[model samples]
Target: MGIVEMNKDGNFPNVRLLFDNDTGIDDALALAYLCACDHVQIEALTSTPGNVDVEQVAANNRALLALCERPEVPILIGAQDPLQIPLVTTPETHGPQGVGYATLPDRGTTASSEADAVDYWIDAARANPGELTVLLTAPLTNFALALRREPRLPWLLRKVVIMGGAFYYQGNTTPTAEWNTHVDPHAAKEVFAAYTAAAEQGLESEKLPIVCSLDTTERFEMQPEFLTRLAEEAGCTESELVLASDPEGTLSNSSNPLVRYLSDALRFYFEFHRHYDQGYIAHVHDYFAAGVAAGTLGYQSRPATVDVETESTLLFGTTVADYRGLWGKPANARIVSSNDPESGFAELLTRLGALARKLDTNS
Candidate 1:
């Protein structure tokens, strides 16, 4: 089942959220979507090393939050390296700065939260047990560490929506692994084991973790035409003008900061996909993960005993879903198989357009 059901008014309720990100292009876009959405109250942001170093990710988080006018949200720095393996970064996909072509304005002297990320996570869980949902859009290093500090963390969290792994689809990092999981397969393994242990100890099935793997996420692609239509609907004059002049380079000279930033960031992602997958579009992987966290997306899910491969050299980091119950273990996670992409994309654009309108007027 999904994280939440619709209310009598057919609307999802506002949810409190904690975000952990590596701040890549898609992560930035997801953050923008979450900040703009009224249905989620972002409690805090935690940074980890993945797309770039932890330091750069933290900086990107601060800058992006400032741009979204959400600098008040606590930014906490977390694991700088993986639990066991040396940290690997993907600067090639996301520009040298890890946020694509867009250069976010300096956030000045603003600093991140003094509280350690692990400490903050434990405290947040204690403060709002069974109420805080976590959106993990990066490696599982920080989360694994948090669980180590407080073994009861899985039981304390209301839900977890992970944007990692590749079950049925080909891996983006290696022949059998996704980037986030591959970056720190040991951590991923530990995390899955923790949840499995929690379930064995009698945590409710509904509270089990949910994963949005590459198989489902790769289905939602953002086309240029859709983005242009959204810009027009949002009345983004700058974006419209840019789209008119250089439709392909809509990121250049757009008056709408959000449009300009997102367009620029997406350009790099689009180019990567076009080169690798022969598609002139970008996948909304992390964005869909955020939607799941917000309980605003319709999807099909199956409960399964999931694990990460950490021992095999070639297949390390591969997400193994025991569909046949060969392991004879109780299900520990919900694997999302498919989603209503059309309606989901529509809702995404509607919310983004509303944010654009708000930013346009405020600017």
Candidate 2:
């Protein structure tokens, strides 16, 4: 069964989502999950530099879309670098090409649409006022820029979902920051500031950005056995065994291509986590964020005023959430407080497995 019970009727929620991502391994999984869902309507994809460079990130997005047989969606490239910071990519985490060991198919004719991502953000919001939900799984570069160009975005769009920040939780990028926010602390600061301004201007609470911080996102960890089960669900002839005890860099020999791609990609992630002593499981962060954006994941959120520290040398990218109204600012974000990662991952596997089965049968 899907997350929303209404989805059984076949035409309940027409989630019009605009994805803004850095196109890393987790980002690829997030997009693939949405592609598998029949109800989610992915309008466009915008690329931002984080796990890799802008050009590479755009390429990865096109390749993942093509791999899922979704080439119609236009990809828009954002600023090459953050608003104010040196761009640093984690090749060690996501591999040099940013998609781990998985190889993507050609992006057919072109890579991106003519629309500037920042401009597209403003135009798309104005064209479909209160009808589009923007999903940001990367640094808030394009969003901050868009807010700068169009100050009314907070009220114009239906909603905004962000997969960044650590709040009072442990940071993945630094001692006090998360990866997406750490990449562009200035941009994140500006984005939060924009929402605070909008809240002061009477922006509805429902329209506030839903933030999926690392605390909740880290709960959706991916194990090697999950890939094996996914392969079986995809109707693969061979058993997909990506055991950490086995030789490192072991590739999948599954008959299904989707299974192969996911296995190979996730194996690298598994290895990376093991190297960092986080176990052999991969923390599928963006997948949970994608689920939250689609409204298919059951979660509870609390209103908080979020801000990023961009100046402190020791805590440059730290994200702080004020739940006590101590900052005297209206809440700008609805921070995800709790969720069931088990059911969320189960939902993801079911959807992706069904999609993979359908693709192989159709092909």
Candidate 3:
């Protein structure tokens, strides 16, 4: 199949998205944004261990989908642990439940797809061929496993968007590594190498892979005032309206459940960041990666040979990019260097808010 062309409305084409996430607060926010947007059609959601365990990730995905009234999208459980290391979680940052203090209704007995995550990814790619965009927001274990099982996965994908790494910004895990890569350096290394090899063997450069590093994502900070505006514009005083009740029967004329859920979820994230980064703001890092895949966010990127350090005792998981051809390797990834967070945030809020109103009116 060829590229999924945009319709006459000049909006994004209905991109088929397969998301692999840890389902942390940020991931939840990203999911809400994705679900609210009209440009992409989510295919499946696969879980991994990062902010929480894989099981909890799946549960969160299911619960959030239920709240969004989109439980039709399948959830698939992924690797229980990293490829060569013990699983580590960041409960401190994302709270014990992985979504901060906000609790989602338990999707009791809500099961994921029986197929292994690796198999699901490979099969999805084969079915969609050149029309699948894979958004990876967690550790790369599933992706590595899938790539190993099927070497043609890279070429089959329309694009791969990674929400990890830090090219120039300080790392959030180690002084030199980001959390996602730090939790699974071996998997990250394997994925970079696989994409690099695929491109060197003749895959188109544009379809190689895109990395939304901390350098760019750290600039995106969700402000409380923005949330306030959303609430006020939606005719609600408190941002917790959507969080206070089940969305199915909630008065859709009041506010959007998507916006309410995001607002409620961000409270804990905002507090965490306030203490962690001395800023009372939440960074929805993964949202930019999704926007990049959707062609809604403009980014400045450059071709680079990006690699992850898997064995440096103190610097394990550090993203090493050969920006100057220092290692004499061809560029394999497009490292996003900059993006207008203000414009991006504006677009996200506008689109999501409009979606909420539409859903409300329909409801």
lDDT of 2 by residue, 1-363 (tens): 112211233344778999999989999999999999888889889999999998899888888787788888889888889988899999999999988898867555455542478888788889999999999999999888889999999998997999999977889889889999999999999999999999999999899999999978998988889988888788887788889897877777777777888888888899999999999999999999998888788788888999999889999899999988998999999998888888888888899999899878877
Q: Local distance difference test, per candidate?
A: 0.83, 0.87, 0.81
Candidate 2 minimal-lDDT segment of 10 residues: 1-10
The better candidate by TM-score, 1 or 3, is: 1
The number of the candidate with the highest lDDT is 2
lDDT of 1 by residue, 249-357 (tens): 3454667777777778877777767768657778878998988898888777888898999998889889999877899888888989778678878877888888877
Candidate 2 stretches greater than 4 Å from native: 1-12, 112-115
Local error of candidate 3 at residue 301 (angstroms) = 0.6
Off by over 4 Å in 1: 1-10, 108-115, 238-251
Candidate 3 lDDT, 112-214, residue by residue in tens: 5424777988988998789999999999988998989999998899989999998877999889899999999999999999988987798888886888989
C-alpha displacement of 196 in model 3, angstroms? Answer: 1.7
Clashes of 1: 0
TM-score of each: 0.93, 0.95, 0.90
Model 1 — TM-score against the truth?
Answer: 0.93
With candidate 2 superimposed using the best TM-score fit, by how many Å does residue 191's alpha carbon deviate from the native? 0.2
Better candidate by TM-score, 1 or 2: 2
